[model samples]
Target: MLIRDYAEIFPEWVKLAKVACVIPVSSVPAERGFSLQNRIKTAQRSRLGEGRVTRRMHIASSRDTLDTFDFNSAAARFTAAKYRKK
Candidate 1:
């Protein structure tokens, strides 16, 4: 109520408030990420590095379903990489 009345006089504060309001009040997203990381870094594959973990997290959290994802291009890129061992 008070914020609405003073928004015109204090535009900067209003912008800050709007940004703050969008922030999550809970840590559910962070918790989910940690949980995904745990599943990706299990005992048998514990040697995975931070870069691998981050990339895996991004893939795991991607909004695109498997059917919509272009796996052929990804496979082509992987096979084209000369750095990979035979």
Candidate 2:
């Protein structure tokens, strides 16, 4: 559908009929998953361990809505708790 929408902009070598728009649609879900992973690894929390990072990332990515996750507040609390022990 996307290819058909932007057929004009596509390279001339790509035959319109032969062009398959399968990747983008399939990748959107994976892209969203990666986006959730990135949000968990922002500048402030870049030093987080892989195990904890992956656990939080999985939860954040699987949820239907990010609003319910409250990652920012949780991350802040986590940071505070860790720092208090230092």
C-alpha local distance difference test of each model:
0.88, 0.75
Q: On a 0 to 1 TM-score scale, where does candidate 2 land against the true structure? A: 0.40
lDDT per residue (tens digit) for residues 1-86 in model 2: 53467567765635644645333546777887788888888899989999989899876657657666678888999999999999
**Cα RMSDs, all models:** 3.8, 12.2
Estimate TM-scores for all models: 0.61, 0.40
**RMSD versus native structure for model 1:** 3.8
Candidate 2 achieves a global lDDT of 0.75
For model 1, residues 1-86, the per-residue Cα lDDT tens digits are 53689898998888888898899999998999999999989999899999999999898888789789899998898888855765
